[model samples]
Target: MIELPTLYHLATPDAWDAEASDDYTVSTLGRSLAEEGFIHLSLARQVSGVAEAFYAGRDVILLALDPHRLSARVEFEQVPGVDDAFPHLYGPIPRAAILSATPVPFAQDGAHDFTGLLPEPL
Candidate 1:
């Protein structure tokens, strides 16, 4: 998979914007993502499990698991059935079910450490 981590769109949106949004929208979006475990990950890799989770069609927290470099965090709408209905999921029944998700720039310092929030050497 070509890890295009440099692509700028894979970023999280600003918090001020969230504050501007109606609380219901934010809470519902968060709930949907959390239910699916859709962690925000770059869409650069084909085998990225994280990417697949977001494909589940729920809003998610996008960020670089690698901490040494700065990255963007953001949310997106998951269009269900569209991923498979679209001509190219690279496989059959490609619908995504998120294992979990979080929304924040700084990785949570506690149990949220499940992802290690650090870069792995290639």
Candidate 2:
């Protein structure tokens, strides 16, 4: 199988901090792993769109995850009404899997400015 690239998860500061265990249980902005059945993830190119659509005008932290470090299985699945397949984690995210967390800055127009947030080749 082809190796997955770095996966990104958008999370609020409070929610990201609340996960004090070895594994993170929160699935998305307002959902949980148990409730959603998986953690929603994005590719480097999808970060800006996901943020604008779901987290506009909100303070969020961008979590860069290393797929190899995660205990959960990451699957690329298609969602209705979306053209591209997104990465979904089948289990809780392990703390070890998190590569870095950076605060997402918003532009004056209330849009998320993801400038330089992603690594090279994005």
TM-score of each: 0.20, 0.91
lDDT (CA) per prediction: 0.28, 0.88
The segments of candidate 1 whose C-alpha lies over 4 angstroms from its true place after superposition are 1-60, 63-96, 106-115
In candidate 2 the C-alpha lDDT for residue 68 amounts to 90
* lDDT of model 1 at position 112: 20
Worst 10-residue lDDT window, candidate 1: 86-95
lDDT for each residue of candidate 1 in 1-122, tens digit (9 for 90 to 100): 43323211122343213233231112122333234343323332322333334323323354322211222233334547434211111111111212123442323432122144333436
Q: Which residue pairs in candidate 1 have backbone atoms (N, alpha carbon, C) closer than 3 angstroms, thus clashing?
A: 11-73, 12-73, 12-74, 13-74, 36-98, 37-99, 37-100, 57-78
The Cα error of candidate 2 at residue 108, in Å, is: 2.6
